[model samples]
Target: MSEAMKILFVEDEEALGMVVSDSLRSRGFEVDYHTDGESALQAALENRYDVLVLDVMLPKMDGFSMAREYRKSNRSTPIIFLTARSQTEDVVEGFELGGNDYLKKPFSMEELIVRVKSLAGCALNQENSELEECFVGKYKFSIQKQMLELNGKVKSLTHREAQVLHMLFEKRNQVLERKQVLDQLWGDDSFFNARSMDVFITRLRKYLRDDPSIQIVNIRGIGYKLML
Candidate 1:
């Protein structure tokens, strides 16, 4: 049998944490649950996990800070932020801090499970792929490393960014429906998730700005086309 996928889960609420962790464990995931961000960060740094589920509010450290610090050394492991805040800014900030997905509080267990499996699947696919590199215009994208290289200068990408870019490249010069991308990565197309997708699209445009030949065009009410 395959080893159970490991997860580092941080949530301060005792009841909620127990429920979520138990649910994940029941679904065949091996989860390391922590009640505070400080200890969670330590666990995350010292161990390898398939994915991270973090609550934004916690004692000693916030999820955003933990994710930022974790990204300094590790960029490939996927992070999903859990928070009560549904504001667009909070969602965007989570993504900016290197989180691959964001789940608001009061979320269903089914949704959380779907998101976790989606992210874990993506990470596993990248790790197990044989092709290491691909090109986008003049830029070189490293699949396993999660990096974009151009002219000797390299820019690291968060898991979501790399995933978005990979999807765009796969359908290069073709319109990739916004809902399609959202469903694949986030497991839902809620308003907050749509806003988060917008933020990622803008970031991708900036990252690929060095090559004028590449453009991620917005279809206005439809979707985006990565014109190369």
Candidate 2:
């Protein structure tokens, strides 16, 4: 068998932590569990983990703050935030802090497993590793460089923006649901995230404005479809 993936899990709740840690281990993940954010952050910085599962409410520091600090030195490890709070702003804050996924409390082990597996698969996709360039309309996008080139002019994209555009291009000519985009990118489909997605969509529209052949259409109440 292949070596098990390492995971750093931080949760303040004793019972929940035990259950989740055990469950993940049973699924072949090697988990290092911590009960506070300060220690968790230290552990994360000291070791390399394939994924980080963090709870928003914790002692010393919260998950949001821990994630922000961790992102300063490490930008590649995927983070999943677990919280009881379902507020839109909280969800937005998690994403803004560099979290890759979010899970609300009272969640089932099955759902958590699915999310973990999906994230792992996305992170390890060989296609993304092999493919460096994608074409949309008259523009050329360099996946490795995170840049868009049109008519000899190049534009840089933020990490989140590049991720969003990458997904849209992957699903070109197909309707990509709003919730799907939110879940894949921000980890939740909260109202605030939906609004934030709109802003990204608008920015992408401006970037592709020079090419009339490319269009990102909003399917009112549904999602968006990128035409090229």
10 residues in a row with least lDDT, candidate 1:
121-130
Which candidate ranks first by lDDT, i.e. highest? 1
Q: What is the alpha-carbon lDDT of model 1 when measured against the actual structure?
A: 0.88
Residues 1-228 of candidate 2 have per-residue lDDT tens digits of 287888899999999899999999999999999999999999999998878899999999999999999988876577889999988788777876677667888899888876666555443243656678878888999865667999899887655567788888888999888888888765678776686677778878988999999999999999999998
lDDT of 1 by residue, 1-228 (tens): 188989999999999899989998998989999999999999999999989999999999999999999999987788999988888888889888888888878999898887887777653266666667999999999976789999999999877788888888888999999999887787668898898888889989999999999999999988899998
**Per-prediction TM-score, please?**
0.90, 0.72
Determine which window of 10 residues in candidate 2 has minimal summed lDDT. Answer: 119-128
Give the poorly placed runs of model 2, Cα more than 4 Å off.
Answer: 123-132, 135-163, 172-175, 179-219, 225-228
lDDT, candidate 2, at 117? 64
In angstroms, how far off is 62's CA in candidate 2?
0.7
Q: Give the clash count for model 1.
A: 0
